[model samples]
Target chain A: MGRVVVDVMPKPEILDPQGKAVAGSLPRLGFGQFVGVRQGKRFELEVEGDVTQEHLDAAREAGVQVLSNPVIEDVVAVYADTAAVQA
Target chain B: MGRVVVDVMPKPEILDPQGKAVAGSLPRLGFGQFVGVRQGKRFELEVEGDVTQEHLDAAREAGVQVLSNPVIEDVVAVYADTAAVQA
Candidate 1:
């Protein structure tokens, strides 16, 4: 089976209150070097077969249309192996 | 400045209701090949200086301690550039 991953992030121009809330806590946690933090959502989908062009497209389209808010968020989708990714 | 990304996901063995909810919807969206879905959280942190080993350690530690639920979730931290990642 193949896998699809969608990452949804708030647009750079928008204010991220969740991120700000977390950022405000970094210093107390002994990580003041971190100047800011933005929170986002991740979706992982496991498909029943091999990865394909249509799968990739559908993953991206679903990421944009279903998982994220286009007015204030940016969506990106990953298909297949994410070994190179730390996650 | 360096960047830190923390990805938080439920342990594979655990049941993910949010994922199930979304997976339940893919078919109507014309992506039935995806048989399952898992929802997770992503934290993007913007640091104030150059990347370093200490920075990475802090990022990972923070990810584990602050961004994820230790009992049922898994956390992975990415340091610096995530160009290889779809995000």
Candidate 2:
């Protein structure tokens, strides 16, 4: 089987309340050194097959439709089976 | 400035309703090939300094206290300033 990971985040123009709250709280929490915080989502898609071109495409599509809300967020998918990822 | 990323996922024993919903919907959406979908969160912590051991430790503490609930989630923090991540 192959695994593809999709990272979904709020579009730059969108104001993430959670992110802002975290950023504001960091300094109060004694982690004032941090400049900011941006929160997002990670989806691990596990397909029951070896890596393939088709699998990649499906994963990307699934990530777009199932993992993120296009009206507010963006998504990018990566083939996790690559040696670069394992490293 | 430096950045650290914290990945937070539900512990294996915990049942993730969101993940299950996505997994079940994939097939209905014509992506029946995918076996499962496990969803989590990614937190991008941006610090106003070069990455250092102190920065890394602080990021970890913040991730544990603010980014995730220790009882249900597993978190891993990484130094994202390195080329390995940028690449």
Candidate 3:
């Protein structure tokens, strides 16, 4: 089986309250090194056979058209997860 | 600046309704090649200086103790985003 990885993140201009909350609590939790945090989505899409360029293209299309909302989010990455393929 | 990336995913035995919903919609949207979908979270923790071993260790602790629920989610990865560091 082959698996594709897709990452989606909120646009830089958009507000991310979840990220803000995490950042705010980090210092108090004794992890003061972190200055900012952004929470996003990661997706693993499994396919039956070896991954091909065609499958990657389809995943990219899905990443943008279905997985992410263009209004407030960006499809940051759409790539094959080689480790998953080997596994 | 540097960013530590954390990836958390629902345990294999756990139910993932969001992933199921996405999988169900793929074929209807013409991306039928996908056989399964797993949804997860990705977090970018920005720090003030270059990423070091200590910072990575701290991020790993936070990833397990704060970013994920041990009962339902697994902290799959804790690494630096090289591209983010260069940027």
Largest TM-score belongs to which candidate? 3
* Residue pairs in clash, model 3: none
Candidate 2's docking class is: medium
Q: Candidate 3 residues A2-57, lDDT tens each?
A: 99999999998899999999999999999999999999999999999888999999
lDDT by residue (tens digit), candidate 2, B4-80:
77778887778999999999989999999888777898887776656788888888888888788999997843556
B68 Cα displacement, candidate 3 (Å)? 0.4
> What is candidate 2's local distance difference test score?
0.77
DockQ of each: 0.80, 0.71, 0.89
| DockQ rank order | 3, 1, 2
Output the number of the lDDT-best candidate. 3
lDDT of 1 by residue, B1-87 (tens): 566777889888889999999999988988777788899998888876666777778888888888788999998436564444322
The TM-score between candidate 3 and the true structure equals: 0.94
Clashes of 2: 0
lDDT by residue for model 1 (A6-74), tens: 888898889999999999998898888888899999888777666688888888888887888999999
lDDT of 3 by residue, B1-87 (tens): 999899999998899999999999999999999999999999999998888988999999999889999999999888888875534
Q: Which stretches in model 1 have alpha-carbon errors above 4 Å?
A: A83-87, B82-87
